[model samples]
Target: MEQGIIVTIDCETRTTREINLALREASLAQTPVRLSNPDCRHNLAVGVTTPLSVEIDGHVGYYCGGLCDGVDIRVAGDAGWGLAENLMGGRIAITGAAGSAAGATMRGGTVIVGGDAGARCGIAMKGGTLIVGGSVGVLSAFMMQKGVLIICGDAGEALGDSLYEGKIYVRGMIASLGSDAVISDLTDEDAAMLEAALGDAGIDARPEEFQKIVSGKKLYNFSTKEKEIWKTAL
Candidate 1:
């Protein structure tokens, strides 16, 4: 039962149900639908999504599309916290900006932010790819185990804390590192990955210009001096 729907944010239409109901009304039942005008709030669309293509026309609240799967999401404006958190699969794109912790602990899929992003974007990411065309705030991609975080602009402080097996790419500046993050040279494979992701996100760039951030291989056992040094290394 796939459907197509439209939603516009307002005061009376408070609940995310406004979006969901529109989808359902358009004959969507775990089906394909289109949504628009999700204002910044909380949990705009945060659960089982299927075969839907949501096109948000403005800013969105926290936890937008958190835990969504089998859907294609596109944002014409900015986003809030927990964007696509724990998403299993599918694709989400933001044309404007985002708030804190966008794509926190996401397990799979792809998220692209065209403009700047707030703090802790891609925090604890286990899998998938988070692409930001502009700067990101502090602690983005902290404790991530797998996947990739690619930023085309400047980065904030305290990134990749206790991260295990993921790759990060920043084309601009970094402010700080987390528990055991380190600066690394981008390998050929890493470059290929970056180019591929960027291409998918419709960003035109050179992979050779990007820098990769990796874990220090020492997840535990840290000294204050080392922490201080790492902090400065960012």
Candidate 2:
């Protein structure tokens, strides 16, 4: 499979280290890479800071695009746990589902999942936008500090538990809200942002149909009277 100036790597024949080295070299050259037979390998393309575009033909295991900056990674299949973990910048798109903690502790960039995501989808996410075209499991945004999470399908129990400064938008049923998570009225500005975000993800949805979830601000300060809330969150 050859394209004009596109480098292709056969993951079936090369070791992970060799593949990554080749990726780094290609990135340095500012070339696009296409990987075939990824075979659910772990730790592929980790810590790459270059602004390269990568196309993976098959499923990828843990940390497929972790700790990257300014790269655009597209996985044609599913992704395992810790997908794009600690990502500083860039975009990671999974055509299929993603495992737990898909964007854990990521400070910036965008992550788009075309299918459902497992538990803790955006756990401890500090910044960035996570768009899930399908449902997300329990504790989806557990302890999220910043960023935006948009779920186009149903959300499981304890959605956005103990979050701070982050925003959540849900277009489907929410089983339950997590401690310190409360519903907030959507504003015109929010609608515009949602529209743009959904457009970027190529998801067709009306922003007005979604509901916003934000921190109740009760957990920001410890109060003796709010012990019950703290007990549940802590």
Candidate 3:
């Protein structure tokens, strides 16, 4: 274990601003920290960059750990919208469920949800990996251009809708595939990637059970003949 300084802040007495300030100070010192009595406050620990660890003892609201880099953040309970949105690096984990747009537009690092995730999970993700140990809601991975979204359980309707180049893997049922998205045969490389991802997340799912979803590439170019069809792809 890496020995480091530790600080604890009580959210009950402090506003989110104060808590964030305290975290900033602690991170600047490269110290590990703990947050107690978090009452689902939005944007906790946003934009923190340090090689340290942060532990939230309870739930957090929207955008917890957003834009994080070079830190490890763990939430003990569920999270609201956009957890880890636009993340640049490092790792964030939710021990419970996550709300809409989890990992939205993230360019790097990893986000792991121990339970289910809501609508638009991994929306427009540019890079990195998102692992959901449970089901995902509708419109998951909508308009995703890069990266990987992995669902160990069922996926809701329009999964990967209008996706550009991102990869999606589901171990359970998919309610529907969105426009220009189709199931493809899992390759050996995909299995290796899935295994590594699940292992990194400490999830026990088997990669063989996962079905890969990728863009069909049928709508890469516009044509007058397929103008009506292109509308759905958009």
Report the backbone clash tally of model 2: 0
Q: State the lDDT at 172 in candidate 2.
A: 99
Model 3: per-residue lDDT, tens digit, 1-234?
244556888999998888888888787777789999999989898988766689999999999999888779999999999999998899999999999999999998999999999999999999989999999999999889999999999999999999899899999999999999999999999999999999989999888999999999877777776887878789
- Which parts of model 2 are misplaced by more than 4 Å? 1-4, 224-234
Looking at model 2, report the run of 10 residues with the lowest lDDT sum.
Answer: 1-10
Compose the digit string of candidate 2's lDDT tens values, residues 30-132: 8899999999999999889988889999999999999999989999999999999998999999999999999989899999999999999999989999999
Q: Rank the candidates by lDDT, best first.
A: 2, 3, 1
lDDT of candidate model 1 versus the reference: 0.80
Q: Which runs in model 3 stand beyond 4 Å of their true positions?
A: 1-4, 224-234
Pairwise lDDT winner, candidates 1 and 3: 3
Residue 20 displacement (Å), model 2: 1.4
